[model samples]
Structures are given as structure tokens and as C-alpha cells.
Target: MKKHLILLLLWAVVGVSARAQKPATVTIPKNKYGLQVVSSTALYQQLVEQNPDQELVELATYIPGLVLDIKYATPDNLVKEPVYTMATAYARKPVADALKKIQEELKPLGLGLKIYDGYRPYHVTELFFKKVKKKAYVANPKNGSRHNRGCAMDLTLITLKDGKELEMPTPYDATVKQSHPDYPHVSEQVKKNRALLINTMQRHGFTVFHNEWWHYDFNEWPKYPLMDIRFEDLKAMKN
Candidate 1:
């Protein structure tokens, strides 16, 4: 009788341990546009377990001295209202790593990056499509933006000493023709500043968006899945 009881207890302990070791299962749901977005924390964790590079890293913490000026977190964006709950930026592990190198390269030149946006949630891309006047400026929800993949960055150079913005062709988020990276009407100084930003980013495996001087897409963007996980949730996971 004593041997039977001990055996039963051991079996129970083994079963409980097996269950505890199993990862939580999560389902990724498709949106109205029939796109499967990784929205839940569990789903994101699963992906990270499979590929550590899939993790969304906070840029400010990952890249030392990285500045963030997330317009959508305030009322200054094209939406004219706050889209993000927090004024923070995130990108895939590799993207953040690349930006860290770019920051190091720029530091010696008395310049550094000021991020306007990064890792936009999928829902915000849908919202921008509905609100923005120019369709060209916003990504269609049917096909998610590179930003949703945590592989795109909207940024520009700033003077590291005083943190003053370096002059570009147009202000961030501008939809005018002058916003195009190759626009020729800008002053000589603005041209030089824009070229510096483009060249530096290009050297670091980023391609500048043709229509937006401040936007750059990581070459490996297509490898990352579209994500809609909120900034608050991502922050919680980090803790």
C-alpha cells in the first residue's frame, strides 16, 4: 500500500511538471482585411521563442542616447490626435542593432538620430488610411506597412550637442511634393543634410522611402510578420 501511494504521487508530479513546461497556445486572428496580425502577447512570445530575432526591442533603451519624438503619441501627427498610448519606439532586434551602429557612426560627426516613428501597430495604419487626405502618404490596410513589421524607421539627423533638428526638405509627415527624397527645389544646406541622412542610413542596410525623406526600411522587413501588439503590452512584456 505504501509503495502504491508513492508511485501515484510521483506520477502526479510528473504530469504537473509536463503541463508547466508547455508554452501557452495562442491564436492569431485575421482582421477585416483578411490579414493575420500578431496582436496578442502570447502569440508574440511564441514567435520570439521560435526566432529570438523576432523580438520587438525598445529603441531608446537598446540604443544608447537614442532620442524619440513620436508625433503620433501626441496631437502633432497627421491624425491630429494621439494614436499611441506611450511616446515610445520599438523595432525588431536586428533593426535596433543596425540603428545602434548608425548612431555610433553619427556620434563622431556631432550628429545623431531623432526617431519620429517606428514599429507602428497595424490598427494605426488602418486609422491613418481612413483619416489622411492623400492615399499616397498612408499604407493600405489590405497590405500592411513595413512599419507594422517593426522594420521601418521614420527619423532624421539632429545636432548631438544641442539636439537641434538638421534641416530637411520638408517637416516630418509632410505629404507635399517636396517631401520626396529627390526633390530638387530645396536649399543647398537642406540638400546636404538630407544626403547625409540618406547616405548614412543606406550604408547601414536601410533603404530610404522614395516619397519620404525621413522614412527608411530595413532590407529584411519582409521576414518579420505584421504586428498590432500595443505599446503598453510590449512594455509590460519587457518588465
Candidate 2:
């Protein structure tokens, strides 16, 4: 009986040590609003393995000559503080492909898309809801913004030669009425510039947001899941 007990104790110790040697899997729980955000990089990788379209491609690297002005990464945004550690832009595979095509189309016109923001983390959206006063401009945390899904892009038109921004109705992230896509109080030059942006994005797979002239949502935004992955983690991901 003593020998049997000793062997059983050794077996238990071996089992415990084996379990301890294995890495623990991280699991993300639903947020207070009950939204199942993809916060785990492992889970995101698994999804990408299942569907190549689920991969979030870095926009700057994927799109040639793509100009990025990530406002959320600086203190210049509506939040008045830096929300992201890196000034980077990323989007789903399909969204990147569409943007690439759009860049190609705009080359002939001496205009290019300048991205202000893209692929916003879910936590940043929550922060924006708290800091932003205009409910119309900021997305509610309850329903997660399309930006959190890597499907929405905040951008404007820029000259390819001088890299200067085109005249638009309002500045990026403006909450004023003039920011509306159909706001008619602006000058003809602003109107023409806004129309050019809206029309070009519409010709592709993007639809302009009704309230924001610089914001565009991919037609397939519904397919991607809301993601809370940080930009640094995405950059660290192996190609």
C-alpha cells in the first residue's frame, strides 16, 4: 500500500508539472455591452487562417504611395490626446485591395487618398464616445463603429505632386454641420473637391458617410468582426 501511494503521488506531480509547462490560452470575455470583440491575437490569427479575407493588411505597406495622417495617434484629434501608440493604418484584405484600386484610379487625376484613420480599436471607440460631445458624430459603444471592424476609412483627397490636401467643407473629425456631405453653404471649389472625393469613392467599393465628407465605409463592412487588437500587435504579426 505504501509503494502504491508513492507511485500515485509521483503520477500526480508529473501531471501537474506537465500542465504547468504548457502555455495558458488567453480568452477575451464580452464587454459590458455584450459585444464579442476580437481582442485575442491568437483568435484573430485563427480566423485569418480560416479565411484569408479576415487578415488585416497594413495599409501603408499594402497600398503604394498611400499617404497616412493618423490623427488618433497624435494629440490633434477630437480626443485631444494620443489614443494609439503608433501612427499606422490597417484594413481587411478586401478593403486594402479596394483602396489600392482607388489609388490607381486617382493617379491619372493627380490626386491621391490621404488616410486620417483606419482600423480603430474597439477600446478607442469607447474612449471617443466618452470624450466627444456630439452623439451624432461619435459612434455609440453599444453598436461598435465600422472603424472597429477594419472596414471604415477616414480620408480625404490630396494632390499627388505637392502632397497638399484639397479644399473640403470641414476639417477632419469636425462635428459641425458643415461637415455633412450635402452641406451646401461651402464655396464652389470646396463643393467640387468634396464631390470629386465622394464620387471617386462611390465608383469604387466605398460609400461616403452621410454626416462626414471625409469618412467612407466599405460596402462589405458587415462581414468583418469588431476588433480590439492594438496597432503594435498587428505590426508585430509575421507576414
Candidate 3:
């Protein structure tokens, strides 16, 4: 009887822990953003295309104004990006929801999200690995990437009034140390703006990777799946 009672108590404690974890839990839906905090499962379907293996390519449901990414476009692979500036969100819902909150908080200041990339195909990740080495900003295709997992994003800030990419210390995939947000030569205003973005993201539910100014992940990233589904496969699924 004592053993059974102990097991019951342990079960009760486990149940309570799970409830506490829900607030921080993240879900992976078709193309929605935010690492966790997903409360639904109505996934956006990927449009299928004819492939060698009779597979399909899938894409996330894009919020209006955002363009599907073309840099990595190929029947072999497809990358999608959210529209910049207008707040026609490009990230998955959890990410979108988080951005929406930031928008509400930053709109009065004339600031907004200028997304460049999201939902990277594993093939593109491999392409980066093939071109860029594993030092600093570079990643290894064999090891896997956060973007491939759909939990990471490459982004920057912009003004709704003028659609220009903000002046950051370095360009995307820049391998130089000068690109670090803390580079001494970078203006204090830029640093301040970077900090505001980082802090705001952290406060809302993200953890910033110190080396990269624009990279952040939901605290629950480990729970998500690492996907290598090619754009072609996604397209084939759509059919």
C-alpha cells in the first residue's frame, strides 16, 4: 500500500510539472513561426510538384505582402521568406504572434520587422555548408542547422515608411569579426537598436545567440524535429 501511495504522489507531481511546462511549450505547424507556444494543428498544405521520387514540396501559408523566398528557389529546393516592413508577417504563427506583440510595442516608434529569410530547406543549409566552412558564422551540412529545423530565422529591422534594410555592421553570412553587434566601430545607435531588438525578443520568449546579432531561438527549440525534407518532396506532397 505504501508503494502504491508513493507512485500516486509521483504521478501527481509529474502532472503538475507538465502543466507548468505548457506556457513554455512550442509547436511546429506547417509554416508558422515561433519555436513553441503552438496550441493548434491546422497545418498549411505544401503545394506538390512532380519529382523524381513522386514526392512533393511544401511551403508555409504566407501572410499577405511577404514574398516566398527565391534565393534558394529550385524545383530541387524552395526557400520561403516573409514580406518586410508592412507587417504582412512571414514567420510561423508562434513566431508571428510574438512579432505581432513586438509590432504593437514598436509601431509608435516607426520600427517594424524586415525579414529576409525563414523556413530554409535542408538542401540550402547543405549549400551553405558546401560554400561556407564551419568556422564562426559557417555551418556544416552534416551537423544540421537551426534554420533547417524551422525554429531559427535570419532577420533585421526596417521602417514602414521607407523599405530599406537597416544599416547593420555586416552583411548576411559575413564571416568577418566586424559584423559582431559589439564591434567598436559600429555606431552606438545601431548597438542600442540591436539591443532593443534582442531584449524585446528575449522578454517575449526567445534566447539570443550572442555571436549573431539577428539570431534567436525559442527556449523550447530542443523539442522540435530536425527536418531535411527537400523542396521537391514538399511540392510532391502538395499534389
Cα lDDT computed for each candidate against the true fold? 0.94, 0.91, 0.52
Q: Report the lDDT tens digits of candidate 2 across residue range 1-239.
A: 99999999999999999999875553546788998789989899877876799899899988899999998889999989999999989999999999999999999999898999989999998999999988899899999999999999999989999999999988999899999999999999999999999988888889999899999999999888899999889888864
Q: Largest lDDT belongs to which candidate?
A: 1
Lowest summed lDDT over 10 consecutive residues: which window, candidate 1? 22-31
TM-score of each model, paired residue for residue: 0.88, 0.87, 0.60
What are the per-residue Cα lDDT tens digits for candidate 3 across 135-164?
567455555566655566666776767756
TM-score of 3: 0.60
Q: How should the candidates be ordered by TM-score, best one leading?
A: 1, 2, 3
Give the residue spans of candidate 2 off by over 4 A: 1-29
Q: Model 3: residues >4 Å from true position, as ranges?
A: 1-92, 230-239
Worst 10 residues of 2 by lDDT: 21-30
